[model samples]
Target: MVLNDRIGSARFVTKTNATTLDPFKATEQGYLGVIVNGAPQFETLVEKVHNLRSVFDVRNLRKLSEVVIIYGYQDDPEYMYDAAISHHADGIIYAGTGAGSVSVRSEAGIRKAEEAGIIVIRSSRTGNGVVPVDKGLPGLVADSLNPAKARILLMTALTQTKNPELIQHYFRTY
Candidate 1:
């Protein structure tokens, strides 16, 4: 079950012409209702709806926060640093390889982001498994969420608070 938390995921509700589905329309006024996955074989759509409602109560929706995701690779960390600094990002998700293990350059960049008061979230690029919490990272682990979902959750969390401790709690709980 690939559960996408992005507001753009409303395409799942449409049986056809998915391109016609508008994310802004779905979330602009408020969550009108659950958009059931049109694929009948995915019978768990109802449960997914219930879970979504329980986890992200749209009634309490607030302003969207700006969270950027940085992809980790053998490349330099300059891009990561730029996202936090130049973009004035409120939060950042580092898509690290395997268990959210950071490369040396990425680590250096992350520290800079932290120093800038941008909440950093460590997410897995490998697409599965929880990022084990590392006290030395000066950031929150993404739990079982991948980079994309981590960005979404971090954006939502930043809306509530900028405290890394409180944001970390959201990472663990949500």
Candidate 2:
């Protein structure tokens, strides 16, 4: 099962050969176990639970930076450019179509944003895969993160540092 899953489904059976692994017992002992066909089998579980702990566990708990996501298309990227240059957005995630390939107009606007000291992240609208770092691009790659999620992370990162390299590191790590 996926670790991020919030819910799960299982079946219970009643028979002479049926096996039972009590969750309550597992909680009491601080160890979960699994049994099959009335026999004791698997008994390996982590001793300590992993947790997010607190908001402080993640970066930039003191402040939340403003970030905007813009799509790459035929339309002018003036809105995004304005947000970064005029309205003073801390970061921008460009959701480029097809392998994070930006349109000429959007790329030009993004370059201007970068020049104006805005942190730009190249993300994909296609939903999956890494946005490869291109020397011709003005901003850092968003790695495997999509546009919306990249905006979220970039906001947090901007709160911590304005350095593009540091923000890029945050993208790769987090």
Query: In model 2, where do residues sit more than 4 Å from their true spots?
Result: 1-63
Q: How accurate is candidate 2 locally (lDDT)?
A: 0.67
Give per-candidate clash totals.
0, 0
- Let me know the TM-score candidate 2 reaches against the reference structure: 0.66
Q: In candidate 1, what are the lDDT values of residues 55-91, reduced to their tens digit?
A: 4555666567888888887765666576577788888
lDDT of 1 at 62: 57
Residue pairs clashing, model 1: none
Question: Model 1, residue 139: displacement in angstroms?
Answer: 1.6
lDDT of 2 by residue, 55-160 (tens): 2155436667878888887665566687667988878889888778887878888889988888889988876567899998778988877787788778767666
In model 2, state the lDDT of residue 91: 80
